[model samples]
Target: MTSSARPRRRRRDRDRGTYSVETAVLAPVMISLLLLMVAFGRVVDAEGAVDAAARAAARAASLERDATSAESEAQSAAVRSLETEGVTCRTSSVVIDTGGYALDVGVDATVTATISCATPLSDIGLPGLPGSKTLTASWTSPIDTYRGRQ
Candidate 1:
């Protein structure tokens, strides 16, 4: 090889390893960001499911005359809705108050999710991470309307 060609060949060899180094530095950051996005999406989905369940339960309670049955129906609705959305419903609570001529329905749901990533650097250890999301929603409707008093 000519003397000038030798320098050009050496430069190409140096540049060849740079791409790998850059990829190594950037890959973990990208992966972590993607995982965060996925986690956030799951949280949002859980919240939406909980909200829908609470609405359904509240509607049922407004129509029904029995408070005990209304609460049970509310809890069941919340659990079933969350499970259908691929999130495990760890616990659920529902409260219905029929005092003051209005019925108030409240629901709280605890949901857990498992997220896995390709690299350990992006692995937010499942136990310590915020893997569970708690969502609550409440609805108030006039009970007297159903009873025909008002």
Candidate 2:
């Protein structure tokens, strides 16, 4: 090849490798960011589900006459809600307190999710990133004092 053609060919070859190198360097970062976003979204969604479950449970608890049934109802609601959101609940608990004519309900949920960084150059592994989050919600409603009064 002529000197001019040689230089042109060299430049083209250099550029040809640059794209792949750039992609290799940037792909991981891009994938990590995407995984982070997905993890954050999962946390938010789980929290929302927990809140919804807590509210439902609290409403049920407020109408109940004892704390045992209230806790049972709350746990059931939370588990069902978490399942619907595709998140596993590592632990869940509900506490109900009654004083005078007031009822207070507290619900806690520990949520977990798996996030995958699906990129050609990503270093994150197949088990994906494991994330855990906790959410708590509480509600207080006045108990009916005269419901069974004569």
Candidate 3:
């Protein structure tokens, strides 16, 4: 047998199972990376939902003329915003400040809304992560000086 033929036979045997071995080593890494990305994406989406909820609720409360109506409107707006964005929270709270209603219309007054949302990360069950994360956001809207006051 020629030396070249012997070398060629050795090379073929060495490479025979390389692809299968590489796949076995790389498959888990790729899958883990994919799972991590999904978890991160979900958290980012929840962050956006919380921001939108705070803004919507604050705006709704600012538009109301009375504290009673403002609180109700803010809570409703926050829930609607979260539901529309497909973000599920284990606990949700909304606090509305309608101090602007008592101030003179010409005075600078602002309505503030604070929202707290606790979301469960256990639903995804990613490794080395906590069970839940809480997100809180506050937004303020200025009352228009020219607008009628209750």
Candidate 4:
């Protein structure tokens, strides 16, 4: 019994630090994967926020009575929506298509709002990733058929 126990003790001693070695080898890989997941999640979140901003801009523009006011309101609405959603863009642009405002009163007309946002990813600490990604979203809302437009 003493002889058998001696060999088992020696084997256990040899394997004592193996767990630490394995952990050291795998920790970075695990952390890298975690970082990647977080980066992707941020990008998806930014896309959703951009889409919401576009929708808000289009809706605001569609509610206006004239093309000039529609364009101004769309820009303001997009900025406000982005701020409310906590999305910070390196550079942003809002484009409004107010041609629908010039259409005949009885015609089915729609206003389009396009929002482009350059979302910063440099803070994510992932190597080999781009510093920024540009995401664009567009939304169209119907103009009031009976409302006067110019």
Candidate 2, residues 110-147, lDDT tens digits: the string is 22111211112122332356544556666555445543
Give the number of the best model, judged by lDDT.
4
Error of 3 at 55 (Å): 0.9
lDDT of 2: 0.53
User: What is the lDDT for 2 in model 2?
Assistant: 88
Local distance difference test, per candidate? 0.54, 0.53, 0.88, 0.96
Question: Candidate 1 vs candidate 2: which has greater lDDT?
Answer: 1
Q: Which regions of candidate 1 are displaced past 4 Å?
A: 100-128, 144-150
Residue 103, candidate 3: C-alpha displacement in angstroms: 1.4
lDDT of 2 at 11: 84
User: Which regions of candidate 2 deviate over 4 angstroms?
Assistant: 1-7, 100-131
In model 2, pairs of residues that clash are none
What TM-score would each prediction reach against the true structure? 0.68, 0.64, 0.88, 0.95
Q: How close is candidate 2 to the true structure, as a TM-score?
A: 0.64
The predicted structure with the larger lDDT, 1 or 3, is 3
Q: Which candidate's TM-score is highest?
A: 4
Error of 1 at 104 (Å): 16
Model 3, residue 84: distance off in Å is 0.9
- What digit string (tens of lDDT, one per residue) describes model 4 on residues 15-119? 999999999999998998999999999999999999999999999999999999999999999999999999999999999999998789989999999999999
Better model by lDDT, 3 or 4?
4
